[model samples]
Target: MQALLKNDVFDGNDGCQYRVVKTSSPNTGWVINLSRAHSWPVERDFGVLRSHSRVATQSTACAKLPDFAFYSEKARNRANAAYEVIKPLILNADGSENDDILDERKRNRLVLARADELDISKTTIYGYLHKWWSQGQSKYVLIPGSARNGQNQTSGTSGRGRMPGDGRYSVFQMGAEDIKRAKEFLEKRYIKKEHASLKGVHIDLIAKHYSFRDGNGDLVKRPEGEHPSIHQLRHVLKTLFTPEDVKRGKKGDKNFDRENKPMTGSSLEEAVAPGHIYELDATIFDTFLVAEANRHHIIGKPTLYLIYDRKTRLIVGFYLGLENASWTGAMLAILSLAEDKRALCEKYGHPYDPAHWPADGVFPAKFLGDRGEMASRNSDRICDGMEATISNTQSLLPITKGVVEAGFHAAHCAIKDMAPGYEPPMEAVKRRAKKYHLDAALTLEECTSLILGQIIKHNTTAMENYPLSPAQVLAGWNAIPTQLWKQELELNGCAGANYTYDYLHLQLLPRTTDDPKSKKAKVTQQGIEFENCIYKSVDDDPTVRQWMVNAGMGKSPEVHCSYDLRLVDNIIVHDSKGRTFPCTLAKDSGRFSGYSFAEVEYIIVKERRAKKLLEDKTNQAEMSRRQRAQAITTRAIAATKQAATSAARSARKADTAAERDAEKSRLRRLQTSMPPTNSESKRVGNVIALHSSDHVEGCAHQQPKIPVEDAAERPRSTIDDLLRRKAQEKTNELTHL
Candidate 1:
């Protein structure tokens, strides 16, 4: 085929030579386009040239070509088998191989004998041997009538499809204005802040005057002919866009980077020893955990912090929290690794054996963690205090700390997956669709025990990539992790030298400021206050109190204090001279006796906020009630005063009426001596009308004959005063009086 296609010329059926120009593959067979042959004189090999009258004729010969063949693994294996059988038979003619000569007769005899012994025909063995020598002793060869590339099959061209970030123009093709309208409909109806379903977007697009351009670039509309179907458009969308593309287009780059971007894998092949490197990370346990104290109350998911030994892939230690990840969890995990867990095991009802958990009090040479809780300044300081090299994994690269990451996944599979409230990845969505935690059955204590058992089983079982389990690899014992660690320790250990592992862990705990305003750590008569509790150094231990007493005497101006986040009952304080003092929880800390720092802190914050909220609500309700009471009281007071004033007015009206009658009788007696006037009859109509009476002058001459004591001591009634003043109101007498 290569020879035929590369040719510059080919003969036509008319005996005319044509120049081959181009070739292409279409729905039809291979077609060749050619130009007219040039007019060139032909020369004959014969002594005399024949004229056109001779009318010479010639014929072309053809032979059958075999199907395409190449050197495959099967063919190579067959040839190699034959060669192996015949290789021992071939010996040099001279015993010296350096002579590069072989006895052909001897070789032929040996080859035939070997073939007969192997039940292979003599001819086949000879053919294989001949081909081997002819092909420079190459065992593998391709024998065929047709040519083949002898390489893996290939399409020879890339597939016809859009790139990942490509648009589906061909799928939704139309005029610019129509396309714009379709996009507006899609975005407004589907891809906005409130996400909608794919079917919604499809229905919306189909409702518009949409058109499509097919693979052949012919525009078709629903009104004119057949448009792109929803299924076809869906296929185009899924093919043209990627998860990251949709993430960016629908949401934003942040979502695409956080959720859709691919993460690379990591390897532990570089690890050299069990205690060389350890990975630390925290994760939300998939299963819901109930309160240990009460099994019926589900506590939600737990934050599990694991310390994984990179070399052996052993879980050195772990810390489990109630429902969240925090720096305290990280500290507790380290504490678990540094201190013996016998008491913990006894508490949890797991068998206690130092040999089975040898890594209990050992620290690794290096600590690795992500840029979260483990990357804090306190964490760094703790690592420094413990003399371990601390390193942070690359941000967004979960694989850098792959050992812990994998450990978390393994634990989830071995334990969390089996729990009733188990939630897989994207569990939030599943949880929203159906409540899973509501059916939680395992309490924190029960869950912890199950997890411990799973870890122990993992440490003893063989791993896919490892010949032995992590425990076996670390301790060189086919037992639990603790046993392996213990056996290895009999030979060598590298946790620390100058100080004990417990002390080292204590050194890394969060430190408190010595500043006076942070009075929680101040050493008062009741001892130091921390987290609303008091911690006092007992004098029973002279060594411990010496640091305190010395610091008290102004021997040191500053003190260093660090508390184990794992325990709220105790804290370690180092004086300026570096003397260590252990402080115990004071009696005032009755409520916080057995609580961990994390638990206590969480409780304090939650309770405080809850109390604050309740107080605010109470205050608001009280103020509202007070305002209502004040409004009611104000109306009552005003009515009472109005009632009192109306009573006073009635009393004054009675007094005036009595005084007016008395004055009118006196005036009538006075009018008896004189002629009675028309105005006199109405003179005492009311005390206020007395001033308008014509008998005012006659009444003005008469004075009331009352006891002096009564006049001087008795207060005047309003009516009597009105009568008296009216009687004195005569024109001339009024001015004098």
Candidate 2:
């Protein structure tokens, strides 16, 4: 309603005059004249170009406008192609047109027209038609009798299109249920099919099930509207289904690539010199030991951490745990190595001390582990209290840690293959650490121990690829000066107590002792309770005896007991036949105060309360039996009285019957006496009263008949009363007797 605004598109002045040019082509163009008062330089109109004459055909005119031709040709061509494909589908219900005859030229023209309307390529329209035709061929069929019945369905009128705004025309061709089923099928297939990738075939299947169409023209086909391709399907799967890492690549891919390089061999040789590098990593074992040594069924799996000298491939230390991999676990393994070193020295009389460690054993310079924080020795004391910088070994390098990483990778692959779908429960992981050893035939404490044993077996036996045992290589290394060899051995053996802290030494306080034999300061006692049941004490030291005595006296001499529980000897209790019972030292009562083996001796042969209980049970049984007998006697007495009552009732009924019979006879006699008066009574009624009046004074009234209850009928009532009276009499008689 608001008019005459001079905007960008229509900038003409209201009062301006213009001249219309009548061209030779019979069309008009306007030229602005700004001489009028209202006219200004801004008076212009661009739409005047449309008023100019141009060619009627789009080809000629479109050529003049190159940009339009550039974009429109493809769009028109695709639209035409889509129209050609849909033309027949729209024309007839059935594809009754010649099957073998494809009119390429006509199809091309139709496709171009469709593309022009839809603004899509002819090729795109062709593709959509091709897919649609492929999918519908089997399902879209017309009944043969429909045409004869006068149903004039049009050509190309297939069940492919829907009314405008119908939900069936959604871009997702398939219904919700069908899509869900498809997704589920693909997921299940992916779970089982290792290398099968989700892509185009799956998408096409979905599109075919539900008919969808793009809206551009009433019947024109869209070139861009086509089924998803393989790439698109893959994108959906990666984005929606698979884990990121699996979709991208495997973990440690880069390290594995580096491992493939030729330089790796040389680097390994240098870094893993006999005692230079020690690799450690944990492996979870799903299988359990088939022996009584580890009899309990593990809830999940056992985690075993192994430390090996890469050069000799000798296991330096090992730890097994039920816990998931942790920093504490890795640290404890190092501690085991330290304890083992001390043990080896004492066991073999360590010909050379720490001064000659290199000669005594294999010593490691570097500690290697996967990216586990506890395994890193970068801190002042890498494992809390552990001395990371030992006297003989050098600090480890970061690159060297990759060895352990490689080991972990190997374990993951191998173990997963052996135990498919197996994952250790947390309980089993925690319990594993409690057990120091597990034996294949018996039990082994550390996985490293098993690895060491295996290495020894492999080297010594002719069963495998290795030519020499790891121990042999270790022996060769040991041939150096006693000092150097012992130093190396000490270093290798000194896995800081952090790794395998279960050893008895870590639990005990370190005490210096003047050896009676060598006059050297040697550890006199070794046992641990807190650090894993280890105990260390000197049996012969006078000071130790004195300390024990004083400690015992502090809490009532009897209450004072041995401090080292692990050192206390194990004892068993058995029956006469020697069957042992599960028993242990009573913790509540201190060792000295608790009853002795002799005092508890009686418990061995007999149950403490069994005899008294048996006697009580017998007495109760006898009392019950006597009470039952008395009840039977009472029942017998009552039955006798009942029988007596029945007899008395029978007798009384017999007497009553006899008395009734006698009464009946007397009544008959009286009847006979009164008979003979029938004729006399008829003669004179006054004559009967003469004799009666004379005898009246002396006559006695005839007695009324008396009714009696039969004795049998009332016998039951009297019987009870009689019995009671009889019992009372019997009681009195018995008292007098």
Global lDDT of each candidate: 0.60, 0.40
Residue 435 lDDT, candidate 1, scale 0-100: 78
> Model 2: which ten-residue window has the lowest total lDDT?
1-10
TM-scores, all models, native as reference: 0.44, 0.27
Q: What are the clash counts of all predictions, listed in order? A: 11, 94
lDDT of each residue in 442-523, candidate 2, tens digit only = 2223323443334233222332222333875676543222322234445445332233333322322122122243111111
Superposed on all Cα atoms, model 1 deviates from the true structure by an RMSD in Å of 26.0
TM-score of 1: 0.44
The parts of candidate 2 lying over 4 Å away from their true place are 1-198, 201-272, 290-302, 320-332, 339-363, 373-380, 383-441, 444-452, 458-737
Q: For candidate 1, give the lDDT.
A: 0.60
